[model samples]
Target: MPRIELKTEIKANKNIVFDLSRSIDLHKISTEHTNEQAIAGKTNGLIGMNESVTWRAKHFGIYQNLTSKITEFNKPNYFADEMVKGAFKEFKHEHHFAELNEGTLMTDFFIYKSPFGILGKIADKLFLKKYMTQLLTERNRIVKDFAESDKWKEILA
Candidate 1:
């Protein structure tokens, strides 16, 4: 098991930041480089507890499909989604938000287990961890961008 934790300070309301984090549409925009798309279940808009989404994306030049469901949720505060079916042996992404005097503090706690045992550990050491980090960083950047400006209306509206 590996854990990736990131904290992002956003100059926006906590509710807005939280909404942006869970917006399915915003995810697609952030991952356009990988052509990620939600093809089934809650494909668009905000996903609530127990909702699942199946996403198709191209990674490392190979197309892959991943399905995840929101296992826990608390509006404008915390939420968690875990892998239902995907490339990884298991994965859980927890989103946290807290109000700051200046704005909002958004954080991501992503933990995952790879599939190939020792080979997977080697892959993580070699590149997979970094790759996943980059992907999460990009997603947070986009969320921060959207939450900080009126642009969020495009997706959240």
Candidate 2:
């Protein structure tokens, strides 16, 4: 499995950052590459432990529907989501938030494995890794912008 970690500082409180990060609406907004909707389990609020949601989106020019479950949830701190079914051989994403002097430190840890063995490795080495990294960077930028702006507060409220 390949793991990608990204961290960014947001000019918002840890609680606010964490809450916004967990919102499906924010997820959809941050991930412009994918069109996702929460089809189950607290579709409109903060997702909790053991909850499950199915997100239908387009990835790599293919429509994909991934069913994931919240394996861990610690409010204002950390959470983990594991893919039950998706395009990967395995996938797990852990999100962490911490309070800092300036604001909040938000981190994303993604562990994933491609389907085909040697071909997957080659694809990752050639393009997928960089693409995923860029995607994460863009997502982080959107999240940071949303969290720092008052628009996020209005949406959350």
Candidate 3:
């Protein structure tokens, strides 16, 4: 399994940032390049604990569908989503938020086990890990953009 961790500092309220982070609509905006869309289950709005969403997207010239569910949540503080059915053997993403006087600190812990034992390990070292990191970084950038600006109201409302 490979783990990717990232921390972002956003000059926004924790609650607002939290909502933006979990917004299906915002995610669709961020991943427009990949043509990612929520096809079923909690297709829009903020996803809550135990909620699930199936996403269809084009990746590496191929279209794939992945479903993940919010397995754990604590509101503006923390949440974890695990893969229900996807390309990966298994995966879990944990989001953490801490309120600060100046802003909010958001962190993500993404761990996953790829399919195909040895091929997966080699793939991670070659390009899979970097690809996943880039995807997450881009997603987080959009989250930050919305949270730091009034644009957040477009989706959160």
Which parts of model 3 are misplaced by more than 4 Å?
A: none
Per-candidate count of clashing residue pairs (backbone under 3 Å): 0, 0, 0
- Expressed as tens digits, the lDDT of each residue in 1-157 for candidate 3 is 8999999999999999999989999999999999999999999989999999999999989999999999999988999999999999999999999987789999999999999999999999999999999999999999999999999989888
| lDDT of residue 129 for candidate 1 | 94
Residues 48-133, candidate 1: write the lDDT tens digits.
Answer: 99999999999999999999999999998999999999999999999999988779999899999999999999999899999999
Tens-digit per-residue lDDT, 53-129, candidate 2: 78877778888888888899888899999999878788898999988877999999988898899999898889888
Residue 34 in model 3: lDDT: 97
- Count backbone overlaps in model 1: 0
Candidate 2 residue spans exceeding 4 A from truth: 40-42
Estimate every model's Cα lDDT from 0 to 1: 0.95, 0.83, 0.95
TM-score of each: 0.98, 0.91, 0.98
> Which pairs clash (backbone N, Cα, C closer than 3 Å) in model 1?
none
After best superposition, candidate 1 residue 67: deviation in angstroms? Answer: 0.2
